[model samples]
Structures are given as structure tokens and as C-alpha cells.
Target: MAETRIRIGIHQEVRHPYITHNLVGVTFSSLQVIHSPPTKMAETRIRIGILGCANIARKVSRAMLLSPNTTISAIGSRSLEKAIAFASENHFPESTKKYGSYEAVLDDPDVDAVYVPLPTSLHLRWAVLAAEKKKHVLLEKPVALDVGELDRILEACESSGVQFMDATMWMHHPRTAKMKEVLSDPHRFGQLKSVHSTFSYVGEGDFLQNDIRVNPSLDSLGVLGDAGWYSIRAILWAYDYELPKTVTAIGDPEYNESGVILSCGASLNWKENGKVATFYCSFYTNLTMDITVLGTKGSLRVHDFVIPFNENVGPFYAVANSRWKELSLGCEPEPSEFKITTVLPQEALMVQEFGRLVQGINGGEAKPEKKWPTISRKTQAVIDAVVASIKNGFKPVEVVY
Candidate 1:
């Protein structure tokens, strides 16, 4: 394992309209087949040990059960009975093991990776432990409460040669790429100028009292941490991770009883690129979540951020700017028309890709893929800035990542 450092070209100049185009070009084009050294290729199938029986683990476990190359061979929780129950219900193999604590999972010789869906404050601790044991990690969303924790996780993973990834499945889906393509067309959406994104749902009785999501002492571990991270990342993906120099955020009238923002609105100013992004995330709103990118000629409407619902099941739709306002009106049969595709569930895609990486696909330098940590860190930077803005009465804040 070696120390890893990222160098950002702050002096580089890029226009707003070309940001998304350049990202796709650079990422997809430069994607070389990374292969691990011959010694590491022999170990395949990538055995995974889950840290907890958290609710989100349901989707992840199901995806693992369906994936042919990955296996959920073990599970751990504070309660051994709970761990055994989860393993039994999920049909773990007869040889599958159960543990009463998370550390045991990291110590398991057969476990090559650990999935951490723990509270925000616990991510760094467990992630570091998993890495120290030379185990790869697939952590849940937000990665950490703030950028400092993100840095520590990256440092630990880099120093330990573990495959560390912040679970953001949206980018793995074909629909996301297609959305970018449809939005790129000048005829459909001329020069882009503005964009808006949101991810929200009712979370009234779901959170536990002691859950880190509601525990302010843990810091920045609430709605913004829970769902705002995604909305912010979508913006960064659209803008090519070119962080805004100034940001203003407000969280009120939509926060939970605990004062954690249930709904938040943020505005960003990236002057060099002449781009602006406005995002809102909440847990108090009606069942509504979507992202719309506004361009000079047209607009792209992403119907659902988490998962597509119906015939039009992707995250975005491109509509001519001329017709966008008309559709927004009471006009019958909205003007925007387009095709739809499903973003293959991210959990499955991530597992499949990681399995290949472990099989030594890309350089297998024992380093986590560049994109995973880059975006994770950028998202945390935005989250920290937004939280600061709210605490300062929506004062404009600069995000440096």
C-alpha cells in the first residue's frame, strides 16, 4: 500500500456547457482495463461480510444474492441473534458465519470486503478498521459526515491497498449517461445556464431516537447528509466537479422537529464556468423527487433520482427550452417527449465491477478507483459548505475541494 495524493488543476479553464461533455469523454475514454498483479487475480468471487442488519442492507443483500460472482458469506451486528436471523432469512450458505460485532467480520479470513451502512459518525472508524485488515470496503451514501472524515477514510484505504468506494450507484446506470447525451444536443437544449435537483421523501417514524441521523453531536448527520449528498453529486456530475466559489443555503420551515433540516435549498456560483446550480433536498415534503437541468434551448427533467418508477424510468428527460414553459403550464399533453431506460440497480453494478477489479482488471495498483473517492470527497465538501451557510443565516460560503 502507498500514500495517495490528488492534484486538482485550479488554473485550468473550462466552459460551463462543455463540463458534462468533457467528464464523459475523460472518464469513459480513459477507462483502461485495470488489472491487479498476477498474485491477486487468483482470488475471485469477492466474499463480502455485511456490518449490520440495517434496513438499507435489504437492497444490497438482495443484489448480492442475485449477483453470480459475489456472495454475502457472513453478517455481523451487536446482537448475535439478529445477525443469525438476517443470515437465515437471506438464505446464507450452510457454511456462512455470524458474529455479534462488526470487527469479527473484518477479521474473517474468507471475507475480502466489508459493507458499512453504519451511522455517519461510525463510517471512518469502521472503514479504517476494515482497511487495516487489508479488506476492501463498499460504504453506503454520504461516505462520512464531513470532508475531514472523508480524507481519513481515503488515507486509510490508500495506505492499506483496499478497494474503497463510496456507494453512489447513479453514475453506474446507462440512463444517467443517456441523459447526458440527450442534454448535450444543442438543438434540444442549447447552451446550459441553470439546473435544479431534489431528492426527498417522508421520514416521519422511521428514524430511531439514538440514530446518528438525528444526533447533532455527531455533526452534519441529518437530511442533508442522508439525501442531500445525492442531489449535490448530481449537480457536480452535471458540472464536471467544478466546485462553485460561492454557496448559499437555507434550512427552515421544512426541518424535522429535532431541527435537522428536512428540506434544504442551496445556490452555487461557479464563476469561471459561468454555471449555477440550485438544489433542494428534504424528508418532509410530499412524495416528490426530481432533477431538472435547464439549458439555453431546452431542459432535461429527471423524473426520479433514486429509482425510476414507470415507462419513463430513467433519471432525466430533454425537452426543448421553447416547449418547457408550455409544458409547465396547464397545457394538456405536456410537450416534452422522449424515451426511457432503467439504470441497472447500482448495488449490483458496483458489486460486479468490484469483483472484476479484485480479479485485477485495472492496474490493480491496490488503489481505490480515482472517481470513487474524488466524487465522494467533492460531495462532502459541498455538504460541509451548505451546513455552514445554514448555520450562518444563509451567508454565502466558498467550497474548496
Candidate 2:
């Protein structure tokens, strides 16, 4: 058997008023053994194009550069000058192409995949178009305004035989995989009892009034689609994408004058197993991102689940068979904290994973992976159910898969 090893280098330089300048470099490597000989080795890197100049695209652009299996092939915007400026600001390679319109990027034969960071309303149109052009689609989260729209995008990808995956970076984090391993262990975690998640941030002044998230025509679902997406995804992931039987809006959701949701909460129930999940999302609260899962024998808690406070390391807490001390003053077994460190950030891992799948398809070794799009549909279905419940006077709405 032949062995293949990949090494990634991460460099960091810090300068502070109280301390002298410092420089640090770290190298991380992964090794895989292949039974096939060297003659069977195929190209692995996937060329990626960007469809918009959204702020979030900046982070993904960096990820594409950092990922060993991906590269920034091109960037497109409505205005040619804007695309040029974005490329320059992001320090894109001189060979990276710039187009005046997204269609041009999609038309480029060299582009094997595209990262769509367009608004939620435009997802159905642009994402479908990208797929129809036979370009793999890496879409931003809050995939669509509703399941119907998401279905259209998914159908296009399926018909075109292009891979489709929503950009949920945290799901690719090493810590997330570690946590899932613990949850799947029957002796350690037991049956799931309940899960609670919250993702919120205070947005005032211009953000509440002028941000695209609060605009009715832009991101109509607003915070529910923005911040709430992560919370809902966490619950679904913890339960392994099992669709809940019923979804009910917890209370009256606060909305802007244009009826854009600003803050909201929902409860999901699995009647068959008596499992319940609750989540709260807001654009009008102190910044907080948390997920707490309680099982019969163990509990797991993670803060900064969406975006880790420190990019290099992700931390989570877990405890099994914890017992109260005498007079309930303290606990007998303290919760243990686990940290997973990575040379690349979570977003880079996401791009690397996406690239691996695309490379497999390009090599004719496999078909497009369906796992990502399947989970994406399940998440959007729950979001749709919650929205229906909120519209129906906070009544319980059945989640009809």
C-alpha cells in the first residue's frame, strides 16, 4: 500500500502595546494510505468561483486560499469595478478571473464549483442557475426562504448532477465530530432527553434600520433565517436529522415595521420518544451562542458553537453520572472540558471537505454525495414548520417531512 500525506501551514503574527512583537508558525498534517499504486493517483484540487461580494464571502475566500484542495478561480459581481475591488482587497491571485456578472463566472469552463453568498431570496434563482450550468453549488446557510424554494434548488442540482451543500462551517469542525461520537455512545450518553440552543446578537441603529438582514425584501425571514438557522441546525444535528412531530412558536416574535422577524423562539417535539428541543434566536440581545444537550446518563454543553471565540481551538464541556454533593452545595464529578485544535479554521475545513467530494466526482470515482443536501432539506423543513406555526397564531404545526 502507498501512503499519501498532506501538510498544512498556519502562520500568526501579533503586535501589542504592552508586549513585544511575536511570530508563531504551526504545521498540521494528515496521512492516508491507499492500496492503489501511484499510477492511479488523480487530481484532487477543485477550482472554486465566487458569485457575490457579500461580507461573508471574504471569510470563505480566505478559506478557499487556505484549503489544500481548493483555489479561488474567479469572482463575479453586478458591477465590474466592485468585483475588481473585492479581488484586490482580498488579495486574490493575479490569475484569478473577475467578471462583471455572475453568469459569466458560471459559464467559465474552468470553474468546477461556485460558492453562492447571495441573499436568501436570490438563492432559488442563482443557485438553480449555477447547478443548471453544471457547476457544483456551495450555498450559504439559511439555504432558502422556505422548503418549497429549497426544493427547487435541490431539484436543479439533482437534475444537473452537481453536488449541493449549504455552508454550515461549524458542522465541519473537529470538535463537532468529537461531540457526535460521545452522543452516539449508548453507555456514555444514553437516550437523548432534551436539547436547548440559543444564538443571538444585539443589533441597533443602522443594523436594525438598514442592514440587509432586517430588510423585508432582502432577507425576509430576518434573524430567524440568519441567527436562528444555526440554532435549529444544532438541534437537528444532535438528533441525527430526525424530523420532529410538531413545532410550536414559543411566543410572539418581535418584528420590525416591515414585518421582518427580529427575535423568536420555537419548541420542537418528538411525540413518539418524548424528546423535545427548544431554541431562541434574536437580533436584539447580548451576543451569545450556546447549545446544551441532556441525555439520561450524560450532558454536553458548548458555547461559541456557531463561531468559536478562538479560531485555533474549539472547546466543549461534557459530564457523565454527575451527582450532587452533601446538602446540594456542589457536584461530585466536575464537568470535563475538551478542546480540539486545528491548523485551519472551521470554514477552511468545510471548503476542504466540499472540494474532496467534488474531486471524487471529477475523478469519476463516485457520484455526487447526497448526504449534505439531505440534511439541508431536513433543516429547512423544520424552519418552514416553525414559520408556519408563528403565522398560525403560535399554534402547533405538524412537520410533514
Candidate 3:
């Protein structure tokens, strides 16, 4: 059977109906098409180009190759030699094109999408440009420096009719969904009361001095945007993506001489019913990513909410409606430990999910899923509120949205 390629914009060239082959470089079971036409068996893959050779790009590049319907068709860097080295060091296919400039990747008709792991400061410029070029975008978070900047990127994607997603790995983990199921159970968890989250890891001396995250001009939001984003997003996810009524800085944020945040904590309150959440993100501590949530009848706890200790399996604890024992020495039932397993890493899952959406858009079977970007905006809005609170002498700042 001759391959029929349908080009959507200058990016996508999708095969109709059946999906054969792994689509990824690996040989695996064929993926069944979600919208199979009454035609023949055919496989579809999304050809992704990568912008920049940032360190995080290495992991995402691997993920793109692992995703069943995604491939790294090209990669670009300011230096042609650097791009060539990065592609080789990351083990990209020999056929993968290496360009000296990001624009070349965007201009490549074979590239259906682009994963941008550039510094946070550069997100707005490149993301908007990628969208305008009709390439689906997988951007690194915090998606923008502020909500206003983020809106521009979103608008560009909307105008060009392309998919947009921020890279937040934990959100795609199976363990996240499992934990949510328990948290959402009315009888088990009841109404949410409070949540506390933290994401912290001590950076090496050199890292603190030289990392982009600690650089004011490159990453002004610093730890708040880097490590804090995960904790904040986790809090928002627990609240069903609802914005807090007010966001207040709990203490003075630690900052370097450059005025970039190094450590910070914030409290989010839904003042009406007195629900509250607190989170801390730091670059001066041991590795930790924790989320603890309490409700009227139950609670949830995850030790590694950002990155599981084990890559293959993740465990979370949940206790629903536990009653005190006669002596009050021990609870009636211990919190049930649920361990979710995954064959692939969470980052791979994220890439796979993004590829699926791109595929649907390519086939005209579906529109871009708004949920991802919506939550991203909410997360950024909350961050903005936190910054405002920090600037206003740690006073509570009302969250507009």
C-alpha cells in the first residue's frame, strides 16, 4: 500500500486510519488509532524539532524518541558544532538534522512540532515564534515570566491553531492520577481543608554561581519559577485547578546579590471556606519533593511528588475516614499505600501525551486540548500573586483570577 501523507500546515504529514509500527524508534506493539477510518493499517508519527541544546533538552529529546508517535526530526543550536555535538551526545538518529540556528528547525517542513527547553527568560520569544511557524510547542515551565507574557504565547498558538503544553513531568505520572482518585472521593477524602507542598534540592556551589536558574537576567523568578513551580502546580491540582482567593508570602524570600530568588514560601487561601495551602521551594536543601494534603475525613501524602525515587514505580499514602482506636494509641486502619507502576518514565509519558494531541490536530479529529494551557496560566497567575505579595511586604495579594 502506498503511504498517503496529508500535510496540515507546513508541519504535519499524517497517515490515515490504522497505525502500524511502533512509530517510535523502538519496535513495540502497534498503537490502535483513536479515530481509525475504514481504510488500511498505517502508522503515524509526529516529527518534532528541538530548539536549543539546553541540558533539559537532552532528557526531553530522549522522551521524544521514546514516545510511540513522536520522533526528533531535527535539532538546532546557535553553534552548528554544538548542535551536532548535542545530537550525537544525546544519541539522536543519524538522520536527525542539526542546524546552527533555531529558525532553521522552525522552517523545516518535516518538523511537526518543537520541544523548547530554553531558559525561562527566552520562552516567550521562541514559543510565540514557534506557534507562528505552525509548529506545535512543548515549552519548559514556568511558561513565561508573568501571566501577561504567557497570554501572548497562548494567543499566538490560538491564532495559528497549534497545540501548546508546558513540560510538567509529574502531572503525567500514573501516580498523580491515582492520588487524585483518592483525593476526589467524597466518602474517602471529604472536603479539602489544607495542603502543604515542598520542592527543594541543594545546588552545588558552582551551580549557585553559574546556573541559569540563579541568574537574575536569565531567570529572574529563580527558585520560585524553577523548583517552586512544581509545588504550586501540585497545590492547584489538589484544589481542582481552582485559583486561590489570596496568595501571601509567608516569609522574606532568600535572594542572591543579583536579586534573583533563591528560596521562597507562599500560602494560598480560599478565604471563603478557610481552605488553605502552603508550599516551599528552595535551592538550599536536600533533595525533597513532598505533598501533604488533609481533608475533613482523610489525607494524602506523597514523598516524591516531583520525581519519584524509583523510576518504574511511584508510591503514595492515603488514609480515608480512619477512626481512633480505644487507647488512641493507633488508628484503626493504616494509610493504604498505593504503588503505581509505569513502563516508561513520566517525562516520556508527557511527550507521548503531547504527541497524541498533535496527532489528533493533524488528522482534524480534534482541537487542541485547552486544559493543559489553562492550568499553566492558573499556575503562573498564582506565581505572579506570590511575587506581588513578596514585593508588598509579605502582605496578602488578592488573586484576580
Candidate 4:
């Protein structure tokens, strides 16, 4: 058979002798052959607009830059000076636009999506507005003060036909996927029996009294919304987003003068499966983030589930079918550490994935994905239950959703 060659993008055409007559219509190159259109055609990269100059936005901005399919198109804040400073400090591209107000970024025709890193109280307003403007929204975690607020944001996104995702960076980490696989295996993990999660960080001096998280108006739920959000989401993820039957707030929650929670813990019970989970979140403890899942046949433990100690790789421990030694001094099968490495950090992967979805919509090949919003809703629902439990004198509150 005569060698066949096909050109894609600006790459030079190369002969593929191994490509058969049946593959003539397919695109081929010296290295490999792909049954698709030419690559030279310009593909749309999702242009992301940052809604605020919050501390978290700095990390996310770097992620957007690292993502191959996304770009930091613009950034806006109430103060133009702050926006300019944030952009400059984050090393935003020279071509990146800056605005005095978030609305301006939303109105920009070039911005295809918006990353809302605003305070929890402002999410409902800005997130909905971004959706109404036909821009995809990547909202920060603790998506809202309550499930109702989250529902409102979701409704707007659904009505406007745009994608919605919470900024749960760890969810996009390769280690998380691998951990899920292990937990789902029947022989390896059996049925999940219980789970315990904790996330906390000590807030010193001004942070304890003046940080937005402790400020009632800015973040009413306080540490529950900031730190507990991760713990609750981790538990929910382990249960595959299944709502528990009841949530009971653990003994006396510590609160600041403004009645904002500074520390709290909760227990979730799933009556149907007899599964139980507990989580503790605080802003007054040593920095720690842990998740331990126990199953009938195995167990898994992760010390840094929220932010990895190292960006290049995340480590987790897992053990199965253990037996005690003769003196009960140790176990027969010891836990082994597994490290999942990535070229880009989890946050960058998150931006890349969100951008990929937006690109699909831009190409008219697919609609916005619903999995993200669904998970976000479930997390918010659990949070609502926990809050209700605390409000009702630490009584158990049934999870309606």
C-alpha cells in the first residue's frame, strides 16, 4: 500500500505506511494517527474573569494561568487599585483586563466564565448575575449561607444554561480519584462502616477577632462555613453524596461575641445502611485536616485532605485485611502510603476541567455538566442540617434532601 499522509494544524505532514486503506480518511502523523479533524483549527480557550481580589483568588489565578485551556481574561474588585495590585502581584498577563467593579467583567464580551471568590454573603448576588450574563460560574466553597441560597444560585444557572461548580480543589486531585476507587472496591474495602473527618487551623490575634470568617455579616457561619465545609464535603464524597438520615451537632459549640461559630463538631447517621460519620471543624485548634474511613474489610486515612503539604504529590494510607501480631503489639498487614503525583497542582486541574466543559459548550458539542452542581447542593444540604442541629439545642436534625 502507498504511504498516506494527512496534515493537521501547522504541523508538517508525515507519511504513515502502517495506516491502512480503511484509515485513509483519518488524520495521520509520524508519531500517531487520530480519527478527527485537523488540529490546526483554532480551539476556543475559556476566558475566566475573577470577581474579587480575595486571598483565595490569588491561588486560583495561578491555576487559571497554568491551565492549558483557560486564561485569566480579567479581574475586578470594588477598588480599582486593589484589583490592579492583585493582578500585578499574581503576575497576570499584560493583556489581561482590569475593572473597578465586578459587573464590568461580567459585561465584557470576551469573558466566557467568572470565578466568584467573593464572601459567602455575596455569592447569591454575584453568582446569579454571572449566570444571567450567560457566563459559567466557578463559585468558592461554602457556596452559600444555606441550602436555600445555594438553590437560588443553581436555579439561575439552570435557567441561563450555564455550568456551575464549587471551588473544591481537592476534588480534582488525582489522589482523590484513586482513593475513591479503593473505597468502592467490594473485596478491598467491603462496605463502609464509618468515617471521621476533621479540619482546623488556629487563628491568632487579629484573625480571631477581625477576620471576615469571624465577622457575622461577612461569614455568618464562620468556621463552619470556612473549615467545616471541607470536612462535610469529604464525608459526603466518601458516601457518594448520599444524604444522611439525621445530623446531630456535638456538644457546646464555641462561638465568638457576634454569635458566629468558631468551632463545632457534628455526627451524621444513615439509618438505612447503618453508616455513621463524624466531622469536627474549628478555627481555634492546631492546623490539621484528616479523613479516616473504615470499612468491614479495610480502612483508609488521609492526614492532609484539604491542602496538600506538597503541591507535586499527595499521600494517603490504606490497609486491608489486617490481623494482630502474636503479642498484639502490631498488625499483620501494615498500612502503606500511596503518593499521587501531578505536573500541575489540583487547583490547576480544576481550572482545566472547568475550562474543558466551557469549551465543549462553546463548540456546541455538549451542554453544561450537572454533576458539579448536584454535589455542591448535597454538601450544602448537609451543612444546613448541621446548622439546624446546633440551633435546636444540639438536637438531631433530619436531613430532608
lDDT of each: 0.70, 0.86, 0.85, 0.86
Q: Against the hidden reference, what TM-scores do the models get? A: 0.81, 0.90, 0.89, 0.90
lDDT of 4 by residue, 80-117 (tens): 99999999999998778899999999999889999999
- Listed per candidate, the RMSD to the true structure in angstroms reads 8.7, 7.3, 7.9, 9.1
lDDT of 2 by residue, 1-401 (tens): 11123433332211111111111121113222121212332444588999999999999999998887788888999999999999999999787899999999999987899999998989999999999999999999889999989999999999998899999999988778878977887777889989999999999779999998999888999999999999999999999999899999987899999999999999999996679999999998999999999999889999999999998778888777778999999985666666677778999989988987887777777788999999999999988998999989999999977
Off by over 4 Å in 1: 1-43, 206-212, 217-220, 251-258, 310-315, 321-344, 361-367
Query: Which regions of candidate 4 deviate over 4 angstroms?
Result: 1-42
Clashing residue pairs in candidate 2 (N, C-alpha, C atoms within 3 angstroms): none
**10 residues in a row with least lDDT, candidate 2:** 15-24
After TM-score superposition, what is the CA distance of residue 39 in candidate 3 from its true location, in Å? 10
| Model 2: per-residue Cα lDDT at residue 2 | 18
How much does candidate 1 score in TM-score? 0.81
Q: Which window of 10 residues has the lowest lDDT sum in candidate 1?
A: 14-23
lDDT of 1: 0.70
Candidate 1 positional error at 216, Å: 3.0
Judge candidate 4 at residue 6 and give its lDDT: 22
lDDT of 3 at 175: 76
For residue 169, model 1's alpha carbon misses the true position, in angstroms, by: 2.4
For 1-401, candidate 3 gives per-residue lDDT tens digits of 12223322322322111112221122223222132232321246788899999999988898887766677889999999999999999999777999999999999988889999888889999999999999999999989999999999999999999999999999987778767877887777889999999999999879988999989778899999999899999999999998899999988788988999999999999986779999999999889999999999788899998888987777887776678898898875666666676767889889978887888788777899999989999999999999999999999999975
